[model samples]
Target: MVVDELNEGRIGLEEMKVGGIFPNLKVFKNKVKEYAIERKFVFVPVDSKPTKYAVRCKDKSCPFRISGRISLDHVMVKRFVPEHTCSGTMRGNDHPLVTAAWAADTCLGLFPCPGDVRPTLIRAYIKDKWGITISYVKAFNAKIIIHEKMCGNAEASYRILPAYAEEMERCNPGTIMCVYRSRELWTGGDSTFCRLFWSFGPSIRAFSQTIRPLILINGTHLRGKYKGILLAATAVDGDGGLFPLAYAVVENEMYESWL
Candidate 1:
């Protein structure tokens, strides 16, 4: 029955032999890792070499493992022990559903409207989709990981602000872009990023031509690694739709920052 299920693709099998001309050990290890994930088991690297690699189950109690060595022409499988002595319960951390890629896919459409992408919502979504309940911390971490994947790390993004602003100005003429930085008095090193303000040319044009004179200003506190405030100015269009005019990221939501 197990062999039939493996043959029919109902269950993934731990193959005793893998024949391929892999470019490197990293590629071979990744291929084995994918196979383990498909079989609902976590792959933990035991050791590796220039032409050989070994991997085992993430569970210390589980005795499943495989070791292979690279040959001149192809990768040679020296040993394949496919039997797992585990208790048959999947660990939350090792499960395929609790991954960064899974989180990115789960929160794909909710990137723009961040307010709707709460941990509770993500937990419910996972439960609905996979019938598995994940903890709040896992869900929250997923949210952060997805944001990092989409927009890059918050601190690192600051480092590229100057180039980003310059590129925007070059691509869209008349775009208002500014990046401010301050040198630390004690360190005397490179300038540290302080604030960034930008307004696209098309948004400025639309605000001047079609948007109402009435403008609404709002600010939100960022909850990422670097703490700051995102201040935005918006106006209503002729069709009574909210039109974003400009935005700025500042260290604090003070009167000077608002100005």
Candidate 2:
């Protein structure tokens, strides 16, 4: 049961700090794992207790075992057998670059435009910070994964469009919002996204008063899992500023979509 609990990867009560002053068992264990991973080593737990914990390198021939004791106010290192007879290079989730959560947090503040995030930039950033190199494929996948983490999935977002539109109309009266769905011929039943159009009340009022008679229209392809196009209309204000009138997401930039 103890081994199973340890393998479950959850921090137990024994691993938690009693007060602000005392050190946590999980904190000590994480620090040990962090140290080993940073130095490119793999370890397995040999023994675990409330007051003491011990871990040895996975390599059978290696005599490395890091053992420490939990004290009243601090964690104390009891013994350190720092010798590994392993021959293989470093691999696995222990590496910082390979973990999705870590990668997401690392790139969260850096990439404002998810589409512009490149593998080369991610690799360069990781190398500069941690002095570790990751493969281009890994970096690319990390970019996508991090973006998904930051923004909800495209399909899921589409599902909630109706609720969002309803909320907008409720919050601001005179808001014009429409969602169109079409059934696939081959599927015979399931409905797919056709088009979505929305114009906020404030924007409609503002455009009517301060915007020019001529409206500029444009469409851009959405580079997401669900391929689509975003169409927008804007008018110039009296002060030469761009005033947004309305926008729509459609299957394509067709005459029907514009209408």
Each model's lDDT comes to 0.71, 0.71
**Candidate 2 lDDT, 144-163, residue by residue in tens:** 77777668677888888888
Q: Which regions of candidate 2 are displaced past 4 Å?
A: 1-33, 42-58, 65-82, 91-97, 100-102, 105-118, 183-190, 208-210, 238-241
**Residue 20 accuracy (lDDT) in model 1:** 30
**Model 1 residue 98 CA deviation in Å:** 7.4
Candidate 1 per-residue lDDT over residues 58-148, each given as its tens digit: 7888887788777654465666777788754466634553565564455656657555567787777766654567777778888887777
Clashes of each: 0, 0
Residue 185 error for model 2, in Å?
A: 7.4
Q: What is the TM-score of each candidate against the true structure?
A: 0.62, 0.65
Indicate the residue-level lDDT of 164 in model 2.
Answer: 86
Q: Name the runs in model 1 displaced over 4 angstroms.
A: 1-47, 55-64, 71-75, 84-135, 185-188, 202-215, 235-244
